[model samples]
Target: MPPPPQKEPPRSFTARWAALKNIPPFLVMVWRAAPHLTIATMVLRAIGAFVPVAILWIAKLILDEVVRLAALPDTPDGLAGWWHSGLADHLITLVALELGIGIASDIIGRLLRLVDSLLQERLVIDLSMRLMDHAAALDLEDFEDAGFQDKLERARRQAAGRMSLMGTIFEQLQDSLTIATLGAGLIVYNPWLILILLVGLIPAFLAEAHFNARSYNLDFRRTAERRETDYLRQTAASAETAKEIKIFDLHRFLSGRYLDLSRKFYAEARRIAQARAAWGALFSALGSLAYYAAYAWIVVQTLTGDLSIGDLTFLAGSFMRVKGIIERLLSSFGSTAAQALYLEDLFDFFREVPEIASRPDAIPVPRPIRQGFVFENVGFRYPNTEKWAVRGLSFTLHAGETLALVGENGAGKTTLVKLLARLYDPDEGRILLDGRDLRDYDLDDLRAAIGVIFQDFVRYAMTAADNIAVGRIEAREDRGRIEAAAHSALADQVIARLPAGYDQMVGKRFVQGVDLSGGEWQKLAIARAYMRDAQVLILDEPTAALDARSEFEVFQRFRELMAGRTAVLISHRFSSVRMADRILVLHLGRIEAQGTHVELLDQPGRYRELFELQAAGYR
Candidate 1:
């Protein structure tokens, strides 16, 4: 069953306004993305802000000039006569000036839009890059945490979704300036007109703010559900899941589940939207009443000879423009606040600091090591879990030794390897490398020294050579090195079968890409370890997909190549286990037995029982 939707605390008006603090930092990010484009947008918008007032003033001059000419004695009777009399000169010039202003406004509007588009694109690119870099810096544990995953999902959406907020903010700036100029004219005529404008618009503005906060709260509460729906949608249609979905005939089940969640989301949104619409209509009617009331007063003053025809047109135009700008400014202010609330997600994700980072004065991992790793009474539990993954663990992996770990599922085999790589730090006790705490070594250097390929290694949808080069990406252009690594892992055999050889894209994710068999993919993954060629090498069930003969050959090559290197191998196959100089049997997150394979078998323990059971299958 789907879990109950999470509840979000009701957001107050003050809380929405408080989100405005995010705008400054957001603008800073925008500026940093493209400084010249940002500056151009601002300058153009500033100039455009005055165009409306200039056009309106020129329109008033044209009307007044016509009125004066019409009232003059001995006026010209035709257009040509008027030109000959020079009577239409000032009127014609006013019309041309207004036309020029209108054209310039249109050009400025287009330029602003072009600049805003470029700036927004740059911001999205910059934000996505920042998210990638920050996520890389985070600990593996952070990705595994559910709360962190939600934050990451929200931040990922915000990286692109918040681009609109940039344009909206600039529009608000331009509109605010327009309002100030338009409002000044209205105030000069009658301060009460400005008062009436505010009074009418306030109700609509308040209603918009209230509804926007509701929308944000609804969205915030539905984040996890939205993520689940997205996952379900992908699962039902993705190439990766297509085979299983078809085999199980899961289309109906998946589609039904998605529809159920979507309907619930739609229903909630519709409720708020309905309420907003109803209230908006009522409030908008009230504003219209206020505008007509002010218009009636202006008309009365004109009829009483208190204002000219030109004054009437100018007042009405200025009043209308001011009212519209103020309305939009208020409505936009609310929207900007709501968007700012979403910005919290992106910035919050950025604010997350990795707990497992190395110290500032961290030293490099020792080269040509005299000693190896020592896990002394190390204990660790995953975040938000009470159960320890590995507890009271003590082991020494000596330099140049090939140690094999034998265990069933959930026996902490993978967790132990992760600890060695410092993907996680021990909760209690410490790990030692060469007589010093493992935490003392520079984290990046420590990871570079150890190469690990796990059972669930990534199948990158990239060229075969690029796949191998990812292990040591700096050497990607070195074709000879990539081929040598592929040869060591027997991946060259798989590559030889591809149409494009090393250039072949070997995943089904992309167009014209070829898919490889499980064993073939394993060979490619093993090649990454060889490409790394680190001092410490680990193969954690990487050959599980290969046949016995192929696994044997791969291990044989691995043993040859791992000479003079510290190696850890985890496998279920007794044939491979017997080759290790020392073997550790793990059960329930602790060492159950430790000896050579023959030595363990002679002891008649769990190791022997498991080996004998496996051998029985052969008979």
Candidate 2:
């Protein structure tokens, strides 16, 4: 049965205000991303903030001069007469000064936007790099956990989506400065006007804050559904899933599921939007009434001869500017808070520390391992699972010998190999290397010394040479080593068929990429194992896609390559299993028997029964 949709809980007003705590850290990140740009933006905004008042004040001076000249007893009859009388000189100078300030204001605005664009791009790049580095440092187990994935998705989205928050913050700072200057001018005429402005706009500000909280809550609750919809959309059209989707005729099903989820999202968003628009209209009307009230008071004072005409003009203009600036400041404050909520997700992800990091003063892995690994009463279970994948397992892999593990599906063979590589620490007991616990060695050095190619390896969309070099990425530039490894794994033949050989792009993900057959991809995967010159090598069903003849040839080459190094091979084919110096038959996560092929086949046990079953298939 499908799970019920999650409910969107209302975020508290206090919670919204608390999100403000994230702003300091967020600004710190912005500063670190581009310090020079940040400083430039602030300096420009500070200069531009006072331009409006300067323009308004100049207009007042020009108006007062016009009135003085018009009331002259012997006023000039025309423009030529006025210029000759020197009457229009003060008015003309005021107009020219205002024009200059206006132009400078525009230049400053343009510069601010240019700096902001560059700064935003820098911030995104820095955030993405940090996210990648932190994710790389995390444990493999963390990626496998479902909760961690959701946090990761949210963090990834915030890294790019929060660029607008930076601009909003800068605008708020500029608007606040404008408000202070305008409010001071209005206060000189009548301090009551400031009171009227706040009374009218506070309701609208509260309404904006309330609705913004709802919007954030709605988005937060639907993160999982959003991820599901994205997956469905990708699956319905992507190249990797196209063949299977067509074979299963799943396009309609996928589209229908996506539509259903999308409709639900639309319905919820529409509800909040409708409410916001209604309240916004009502509160906007109140704000307009407040501005007019202040205007009426200014006119009354002018008519009573308590103030001059120029005073009325200045006071009215100041009141209107203050009202508009205050409205925007309140609205932007709410928006900034909402964006800060998302910043919490990004910072929270950065706070996540890896649980499996190497201890301080850890020793490096021993070279030319004199003694191989020993697993003593080891047991493990996957996270959030009750059943153990492997338990009570004990074994020794001696140095300079090839060990083959033969088992059916769910026999814990792959789990055992992961433990050997220390991709995961055992939940119980210990795995020792050269008489010391595996945890005592440096994690990176230990992994560097062991080469492992799992069954479900990644098929990177890269050049053919890069595919093999991934096994030992430090040797990526060594073309000779890459070619030798490919030859050893019989992948050279596959690469030679491509138009560009080793330099040819593989995988269908990119344009001009050449796709390979399943067997050919497996051969490339096997080559990665040979690329690493490690003390221990493990191949987990590396040739499962190859034909019997090809598998036989690959295993022959594999045996030759294991000369003085410890190796572990896993294969279902009895032909390859019989070649190992010793084989361990596993059942239900336990070692059922261990011996040479002839010895195991002679015994009347599970190994003989499984071998006979495969033999019967040939009949």
Candidate 2's C-alpha runs over 4 A off are: 1-10, 76-85
In model 2, how many backbone clashes occur? 0
lDDT of each: 0.90, 0.89
Estimate, for each residue in 190-213, the C-alpha lDDT of model 2 and write its tens digit.
889999999999999999988988
* Model 2 local distance difference test score: 0.89
User: If scored against the real structure, what TM-score would every candidate get?
Assistant: 0.97, 0.95
**Once model 2 is optimally superposed onto the true structure by TM-score, how far is the C-alpha of residue 480 displaced, in angstroms?**
2.4
- TM-score, candidate 2, is 0.95
Candidate 1 lDDT over residue span 166-220, tens digit each? 9999999999888888888888889999899889999999999889889988888
Per-residue error (Å), model 2, residue 326:
1.8
